[model samples]
Target: MNNKEIVAQAVYEVVEEQLTLAEVERLLENPKSVDHGDVAFPAFSLAKVFRKAPQQIAAELAEKINPDAFEKIEVVGPYLNFFMKKEVISSMVLKEIAKEDQSFGDSNIGNEGNVTIDMSSPNIAKPISMGHLRSTVIGNSISLILSKIGYNPIKINHLGDWGTQFGKLIVAYKKWGSEEKVKAEPINELLRLYVEFHERAEEEPELNDEARAWFKKLEDNDEEALSLWKWFRSESLKEFNKIYGMLEIDFDSFNGEAFYNDKMDEVVTLLEEKHLLQTNEGAEIVDLEKYGLNPALIKKSDGATLYITRDLAAALYRKREYNFVKSLYVVGNEQSGHFKQLKAVIKELGFDWSDEMVHVPFGLITKDGKKLSTRKGKIVLLEEVLNEAKDSALAQIEAKNPDLPNKEEIANQVGVGAVVFHDLKNDRLNNFDFSLEEVVRFEGETGPYVQYTHARAMTVLGKADFTVDPEAVYALNDADSWEIIKLLQSYPEVVIQAAEQYEPSVIAKHSIKLAQAFNKYYAHTKILVDDEQRDARLALVHAVTVILKEDLRLLGVHAPNRM
Candidate 1:
C-alpha cells in the first residue's frame, strides 16, 4: 500500500472497534486547508450509532487510540484530526517515484482480460470533421488507460463504408465528377459531387430512386457497382490515414459495416430459427415491445439489411473471435435508441453476454450554435483545424522562444496537443463549442500550458548534475512542497479512476491540478540550493516530469521536453 493507504489502514484499526473497515475508509477525508490537519474523520455519523454526542465520541476516541503512523491525533469540535509525519511521507513518496519511474501508476487488475472498442466510424467519401474528434480521442484514451491497467484493448475504427451513402456517392460521381479531379483530390471532389447531388435531387426526385437502385445493385455484387464502391473506399481511406497520422492514432481493425455483408445471413437464420424475427409491413424485425423498446428492423422489404443487422452479426463475430469481456461502442448520443434496440435484440437472441456490450455515447460538437452538417457543407475540416493550431503554436514559439531547437517538431506536438487536450478536458457527454482561438491559447487550462509546465520541470531536472538517491531521506515540510507531494501521490488513484469510469477527463483535470501545484512551488522554491537540497529538489522535479508526461500520454497528448 502507498503512504496514504497505510495511514488510512492505521485509522481503520482503531475505528473498526465501533465500525467496519469499509466505513472507516469511506469516512476518511483529506483536509482542504493545512491548518485543519492532514486527514479528518467526522464523528457526527458515529454519534448516532453510539448514542452519544459527536464531540464526546471524538474526544474519547482521540484519547484512547494512538496510531504509530500519525505524529499526533486530536479532537477538534466533533472531528478527529490526524497529523502525518511530513519527513516520513515525503521520503516514502520520493522513493516510490524513484523506484517506479514511468510505471508509477500501472496496475494488474485487468490481467488476462480483453476489451473491444468501436470508435471513429466516419462515413466514406467525406472528410472527417470536428464532430468525429470526440469519439476518436475519447476511445483512444480509454484504450490506453485500459492497457495501462493490464487489459488487452482492441481498437477498431469501424469505418462507415456501407449503406445507401455509397450509392449516392456513385450517382453524384457519374453525373458531375471528373476522373482527373477525383484522382488529385478524392475526398473534397467527392464531397462536392455529393453536395451537388443533394441540391439537384431536391428538384430531380428521380435521383433518389436511382441511388437506392444503385445500392441494391452494389449489394447484389454487381461488378460495375463493386468497382466504384471499392474505389471510393480506397480513396476515402487515403484521406482518413493522413488525418490519423496527424493525430498519431492507429486501429487494430478496420472491419466496417461492409465486412459483415456475408455474415449477416447466418445471423438472420439464427434469429428466424429462434423465433425472434417477425415480419411487419414486409420488413424483417425483432419484436421488442415486450421489453419496452421499439421493434429492431433487421432487413428492409426490398431485402437490404440495416445497420442493426450488421451490428448484430459483428457483435456475435467478435464474441466468437475475441471472446471479449466487454465490447464498447463509442458512438454519439443521437444513436442511443439504436443501441437500445441492438442490445435488446441481442438479448432476445439468447446471448446473455449482451450485457457486456456497452454504448459509450458522447454529445455533439456545435459551430456558432448550430449542429455540424456535411450535407450543407457547413462543417470545419479536421485538417484545417489541426493546421491552424500548428500555425498558432509556431507563431508563439517564434515570438517567445526563438532560439529553441527543433522548432517545427515542438510546434507539431504543442499544436496537435492543444486541439486534442481541449476536447478531452471537458466531460465527454457535455456539448462543447468548437473554437480554434480558445483551444490554442497557451495560457489557462490549455494543453500548451501543461506542456510548458512539463518542459519547465524537465529544464530544472536537466540543470541538476547529480542523480537522485532513492535511499536519501529529506525533510520537505514546506506547504508548497507538501502540496506537490500530495498531488503526486494521488496520480495512481487518478489513473485507476480514469480507466474505471472510461473518462479521459479525469487525467486531463489531474494534469492541470498537478501543473498548477508545481508552478506555484516553482515560483517560490529554488531547486538549486545547497548540494543535498538541490538533489532532493531534483528528485521531486523528476517525479513531476515523469507523471506529467505519462498523464498526457494517457490522454493522447504529446508532452514536448523543450516547448
Candidate 2:
C-alpha cells in the first residue's frame, strides 16, 4: 500500500470503536490550507452516533488515539487534523515511482474482466468530421483507463455502412459519377455526387422512389448493386485508414450495421415469441409508451429493417461472442432516446443483464455557436483540422528553435496532443467551441505547457549525475518541495477515481496542477546544487516525469521529451 492508504488505515485503527474502516476512509479528506494539516477528518457526522457534541467528540477521540503512522495530530474545533513525516512520504513516493516507471499508477482490481467499447461510427461515403472527435478520443481514453486497471478492453469501430443513404449514393453514381474520377479521388468525388443528388432530388421528387428501389435491390443482393457498394466501402476504408494511422487508433473489430443485417431476423422472431411486438400503421414496433419512451420501430411498412433492430442484434451478438462484463456505447447525446428504447427492449426480452450495457453520451461540437451538421455539408473535415494544427506547430518550432533535431516528429506530437488534450480537458457533457488558436497555446493550462514541463524535467534529470537513494534522509526542507511530494503521492488515487467515474478530465486537471506546482518549485530551487539536496530534488523531478507521461497516455495524448 502507498503512503495515503497507510495513513488512512492508521486513522481507521485509531477510530475503530466509533466507525467502520470504510466509513473512516470515506470521511478522510485533504486539508485545503497547509496550516490545517495533510489530512483531516470531520466529527460532524459522528456526533449522533457518539451522542456527543462535534467538538467534544473530536477532543475525546484525539486524546484517546495513539497512532504511530503520523508525526502529529491535533483537534481544531470539530476537525481532527493529521500530519505525516515529510521525509517518509517523499522517500516512499519517489521509490515507488522509480521502481514502477511507466506503470506506477496501475492496479489489478479488474483482473480477468472484459469490456467491449463501441465508438467512432462514421458513415460510409463521408469523410470523418470534427463532430466525430469527441466520441473517438473519449472512447479511446476510457479504453486506456480500463486497460490500466487490468480490464481487457475490446475496441470496436462500429461503422455506419447501411441504410437508404447507400441507395442514394448508388443512384447518384450512375447519373453523374465516372469510374476514373471515383478511383482517383473517392471520398471527394462521392461527396460531390451525394451533394448533387440532394440538390437535384428537390426538383425531381421521383428520385426518392428510384433510390428506394435501388436500396431494395441492393438488399436482395443484386450483383450490380453489390459491386458498387463493395467498391465504395473499399475506397472509403483506404481513406479512413490514413486518418486512423495519424491518430494512432486501432480497432479489434470493424463490424458495422451491415454485418448484423442477416442476424436481425432472430431478434424479430424472439420479440414476436415474447409478445413484445405491436402493429403501428402496418409497421412492426415495440410499444414503449408505458416505459416513458417512444415506440421502438423494428421494421418499416415496406419490410425494411431499422437501426434499432440492428443495434439489438449487435448487442446480443457481442454478449454471446465475448461475454463481456461491460459493453459501452460511446456516442452523441442526441441518441439518448434510442439507447433507452434499446435497453428497454432488451429487458422485455427476459435478459436481466441489460443493465450491464451502458451508453456514454457526450455533447456535440459547434462552430460560431452553431451545431456542425454533416448532412448539410456545413462541417470541418478532421483531416484538415489536424493538418492545420501541425502546420501551426511547425511554424512555432521554427520561430523558437530553428536548429532543433527531429523537429518534424516533435511538431506532430505537440500538434496532435494539443487538439486531443483540449477536447479531453473539458467535461464531456458540456459543448465546446472549436478554436485552433486557443488550443495550441504554449502557456497556461494547455497541452504544450504540460509537454514543455516534461521536457524541462528531462533536461534537469540529464544535468544531474547523482543516484536517487530512497534509504537516505532526503529532506524536503521547503514548502514547494512538500507540495510537489504531496501531489506525487496522490497519483494512484487520482487514476483510480478517473477510471471509476469515467472522466478523463479528472486526469487532465490533475496533470496541469502537478505541472504548475513543479514549475513553481523549479523557479525557486536549483536541482544541480552541490549538496545532499541534489539527489533528493532529482528524485522528485524523476517522479514528476513518470506521472505526467502516464497521465498524458491515459488521455490518448503523446508526451514528448523535447519541445
Candidate 3:
C-alpha cells in the first residue's frame, strides 16, 4: 500500500467505521508542502456524520487515531495532516525495490488477455518518414507497458501494400524506371515515380485510366503485375526493416492490406446479406446517417474495395484469431470518423464486441509548421533523422567522457532514445513542431538527461562496489531523500495509470520527475561520505538505477549503465 492507503486505513479505523475505507481513501489528499505532512484529510465530509464543526472533528479524530504508523498527526485548519514515519517508510521502500529489482512493477491485472495493436503501417515503396514515427514508437511503448502488467500484446504492422498507388508505380516503372536504378535504391526511386505519376496525371487524365487498368490486372493475379508487386513489396520491406532496426522495434505480424484482398469479399457478402450495404451513385456503402458519420464506402464505383472494407475484414479476422480483449488501431486523428463508421458497421452486423475496438488517434509531427508530404518530396526520412541524432549523441559523449567504453553503442541508445523520448513526452493528441537539435540535446527534460542520471547512479554504485543484500538497514530518511523515496515507491501505480489511459506520456513524465528529483538530491546530499548512513545512501542509489531503467524500458528506451 502507498502512503495514501496507509493514512486512509488509519483514519477509517479511528472513525469507528463512520466512513468506509473506500470513502476515507477518496477523501485523502497530499499536503501542499512537506511542512503540512505527507497525506492530509479535510474534515469537511465527516461533519454531517458526527454533527460537529470540521475543526473540532479533525482535532477529535487526531487524538483517537493510532500513532504507530505515523510519526505524528497534526490538526490545522480543519484538516488532519498525517506525517509518516520517515525511517520506517524509507527503509521499507528501499528494501522492497532491492528485492523486486527489474520486476518491481510487475502485475497480472490483464490476466494474459490478448491486445492487437495496429501501428506503424508505412506505405510500401515509400521511405518511412517522420510522419510515421508517432504510431511506431507510441504503439511500441504502449505494448511494453501493457505487457509489464501481464497482457499479451500482439503488434501488427498493417502495411499499405495494396492500393491504386501500386498501379501508378507499375506504369511509372515501365515508362521511366530502370531495373538497375530500382535495385540500387528502391524506395527513393519508387517515391520519385509516384510523385511524377501524380504530376503527369494532372495534365494527362488518360494516365489514371491506364493505372486503374493495371491495378485491375494486378488484382486478378496477372503474372507480370504480380511479379512486380512482389518485388516492390520485398524491396520495401528491406528498407523499412533498416528503420525498424534503428529503433529496435519488431512487430508480431506483418499482414497488410494486400492480405485482406480475398477476405474483403466476405465482408461485402456479409453486409449485403445483412442488408447493411446500400447503393449510392453506383458505389456500395453502409449508411451511417443515424450514427452521425458519413456512409462507410465499402466498394468504389469501379468495384474496388476501400480502406473500410479491408479494415472490416481485418477487425473480424483479429477477433476470430486473437480473441482480443481490446483491439487498438494506432492511426492518425484524421481518420477517427472512419473508425467510428467501422464500429457502427460492425454493430450493424450484430456483433456485440464492436465496443472492444478502440481507435488510438494521435496528432501530427510538423516540420516548420507544415505537415510532411511524400508526394511533394518534402519528407524527413526516419533513417536520416536517427543517424543525425546518433551523430549528435556521439559528439556530446566524446566531449563529456572521452574514454567511455562502447561509445558507438551508447551513442546509438542515447540518439534513438532522444528522438523517441521527444515524441512521447507530449500529450498524444497535441500537434507539435519538430527540431532535431532540440530533441537530441543532453540537457533539459530529454531522454539523455534521464539516461545520464541513471548512468550517474550506476557509476556511484560501481565506485562503492555496492551489492544489495536485501537485508541491510536502509535507514537514511533525511528530507533530501524523501522526494526520491516517494517517487520510487509510486512506480507501480504509474505503470497501471499508463496502461489504463493508453498513454505513454504518463510514464515519460514520471521518468522526467524522478530524474529531476534525484539530480537535486545528489546535489544537496553528501552520498559517499564515511558515516553510518553510507551504505543506506548507496542502497538508495541502487534503487534509483533499477526503477529508472524500468521506467525507460516501459517507454521503449534503453538506460545505459555508462554514458
Give the Cα lDDT of each candidate.
0.88, 0.87, 0.93
Clashes of each: 0, 0, 0
lDDT of 1: 0.88
State how far residue 460 of model 1 sits from its true place (Å): 1.0
The alpha-carbon RMSD values of the candidates against the true structure, listed in the order shown, are: 1.7, 1.7, 1.3
**TM of each candidate vs. truth:** 0.96, 0.96, 0.98
Q: Ranking by TM-score, best first?
A: 3, 2, 1
Question: Deviation in angstroms for 34 in model 3?
Answer: 1.9
lDDT of 2 by residue, 279-383 (tens): 899999998887899999999997888889999999999999999988999999999999999999999999987898999889878888899997777889999
What is the C-alpha lDDT profile of model 3 across 1-563, one tens digit per residue?
Answer: 78998898889897756878898899889888999999999999989989999999999988889999998899997999999998988999999988889899899999999999999999999999999999999999999999999999999999999988999999999998999998999899998888888989999999999999999999899999999999999999999998999999999999999999889889988998999889999999889989888899998897878889899999999999999999999999999988999999999999989998999999999999999987677899999999999999999999999999999999999999999999999989999999989998888999999999999999999988889879877976688898999998898999999999899999999989999999999999888899999989999999999998998998889999999
Better model by TM-score, 1 or 3? 3
Q: Which candidate is the best by lDDT?
A: 3
Per-residue lDDT tens digits for candidate 1, residues 28-85, read 8887877877888888888877899999988888876656767788788888888877
Instruction: Report the C-alpha displacement of residue 145, candidate 2, in angstroms.
Output: 0.8
